[model samples]
Target chain A: MSLVMAGVVGALFGAGLLVSGMTQPAKVIGFLDVAGGWDPSLAFVMGGAVVVYGLAWRLVRARRREPWFDAAFHLPTRRDLDARLLGGAAIFGVGWGLGGLCPGPGLVAAGGGATTGLAFVAAMLVGLLAQRRFARG
Target chain B: MPTSWLLALGGGALIGAASALLFLTHGRIAGISGVLGGLLPPAAPDRAWRLAFLVGLVAAGVAGAVVAPSAIGASVRPLLAVVAAGLLVGFGTGLGSGCTSGHGVCGLSRGSPRSLAAVMTFMATGAATAFVAGVVS
Candidate 1:
């Protein structure tokens, strides 16, 4: 059941990404180009997502003691601001601007038969593997 | 165009719904980076759901190609740039512990202060990089 739910949710998320024009690296890059040919479509996508998630999350949190598949909510509890967070985010930002492929969209776009998207995901997997091997915390 | 806005909003809503479903059912954040990251190291007990989610995500693009090919844009970048971008994105997301879906979408919706900071930093940096890259090119 949990797997089924995960699959369903993921499918919806991927479809949303495509529909929002996020599969297009150029479109995503356009959104980030404030001083150039700027596109505000991605902003609208974020806005629409936040609004819905905010309302629905609140209602769900209010009534639920635990999730249907888990004993407790596995939310993040960290609050402190740290260099690791800032530096990592900065790096992520550079990559995002460079290629316009975040994790989710990268995978989705690869599924759409984009060679560059496949390249991105493959490299990303290497990065992830490297982190696990070298950075033990 | 107005249709762009409509699609953006509509697609975003679906993304939110997917996230919400995952959260409500599994008590876990729908963070793509984290989810995929876990698989690299092979967190045995939780692998099934993550794999299912990813499969569904890919299916979405495959389906989109058949139904709405225009929505699924082709890749547009040199191979080297794409690989480097992927490496940065992977490392950064691993270091930071989340990506756009996790931090920008789920974190912001949950009103996490840390996520807010991450979002601001990444957005600013992303925009700045794109703007500067444009100037350079």
Candidate 2:
């Protein structure tokens, strides 16, 4: 049941990405190109998402002590701003600008069998595995 | 607001709603990178739901492509650049511990200072990269 629920949630999220144009590399790049013909659509998307989620978070905290399917909330507890976070994010940003495809959108497009999406996802998985291997050593 | 902008906002709300639903039922953040990355090594016991979620995400992509092909937009970047971007994105997200979904959406909604910093850093660098890429190409 929980697995089904998770799938439903994932589908909903993917639909949102599709609707918001996140799956469109050109649209994403346009948003990022502030010095060029800046598109503010992505900002609106983020703003809407943040507001809704923020409200829902408050409501959940006030109403429930524990989740229905889990023992406890698995929330991030770290508050410190560290070099790893900043540096990694900086690198990710460059890649995002170049590709205009993040994990969610990339996965979605790949699933749809786009050649470019498949290629990107393949390289991404390799990179992910490489990072883990490096970290372990 | 334009129709596209309104659609973007609505789409974002859907993403947020999905996140909220996952949190409400499973007590998990809908961080795409974290959820997908956790499936790598030292696999968690709760891998079932994660796999289910990804399956649903992919399924949605397929559905969207069939129903609304234009929204899924094609990539203009060459294969090599796309691959490079994919590698950087995967490695960087692994190092940062989150991507846009995790830090930009969930973390910010929860009012995490760390997330704020990460978002700021990535947004700045992403814009800068886009600007440079535009200049060069």
Candidate 3:
């Protein structure tokens, strides 16, 4: 059941990726262009997402527990703003801005049937490995 | 623009909804960046959330397809490449302490200085890759 649900989510997410034209690298780049023909779609996408999330988070917080779930809410524990976190974020941003296929879109693409997504996903993993080599206890 | 915009909005909602739901239920974030990041040096507890998160992600895709049959695209990337990318992302997540959504959506929104840094780096790298792959390579 859970596995099936996961696949369904990926498909929906991927469908969204396709619909948003994000699967096309050029579109993603356009959005990132800032000074060029800037595609404000990214902002809209983010806006829509954050808005929904904000509402969900508020609802969950009010309940003190997630309805239909088994755990308490979690917020970040380490607030030191360390180098590892910063470095990782930078790498991730570069990848997203460049490829237009961060983790979310990658999974969606994988489901949607894009081979380039494979490359993006692979490189992403390698990046992960490199980061782990320096993982702290 | 309409196809992409609508899709992007819907996609963002789906992605956000899944993550939000999971977090609300599990008290966890669905940032692939962080979940994969935590998996390195994997053991029992570390694997639990990581696996669950992934399972949930995949399940979501399947469900999305069934719910909205029209959204499915008829495209396929090389399977080998896709698997390779997944492995690479596994590694990247380990090092970076998160993947795109983990850092890009959840972390960045929360004002995590690290997520901001991570987002910057990857966006650049992705752009560099696209420039090379799409234009140069």
Q: What TM-score goes with each of the models?
A: 0.96, 0.98, 0.72
Q: Could you tell me which residue pairs clash in candidate 1?
A: none
Q: Flag clash pairs in model 2.
A: none
Model 1, span B1-137: residue lDDT tens: 68888888898888888898888998888889998987886464688888999999998978887888777665555788789889989998888888898998899998898899989988988898777766776
Residue-level lDDT of model 3, residues A3-114, one tens digit each, is 3444344344444444555555556667765655667676666666666776776677777744344444667766566665555545444445444556765655454344
lDDT per residue (tens digit) for residues B1-137 in model 2: 79889989998999899999989999999999889888988667789888998888888899998999887879868889899989989988888888899999999999899888988988888899888888888
Better of 2 and 3 by TM-score: 2
DockQ of each: 0.80, 0.85, 0.34
Candidate 3's iRMSD? 4.6
- State the lDDT of candidate 1 residue by residue for A14-131, as single tens digits: 9999998888888888999988878888888888888988888888999999999889988999988898788888989988888888999899878877787789999999887776
lDDT of each: 0.86, 0.89, 0.57
- The fraction of reference A/B contacts recovered in model 3 reads 0.40
Give the alpha carbon lDDT tens digit for every residue of B6-108 in model 3.
Answer: 6678767766676676565566676765664556454336465466555545444455455653343322324443454445445555556676666666766
TM-score of the B chain in model 2?
0.97
Give the winner by lDDT: 1 or 3.
1
Best candidate, TM-score: 2
True-structure lDDT of candidate 3: 0.57
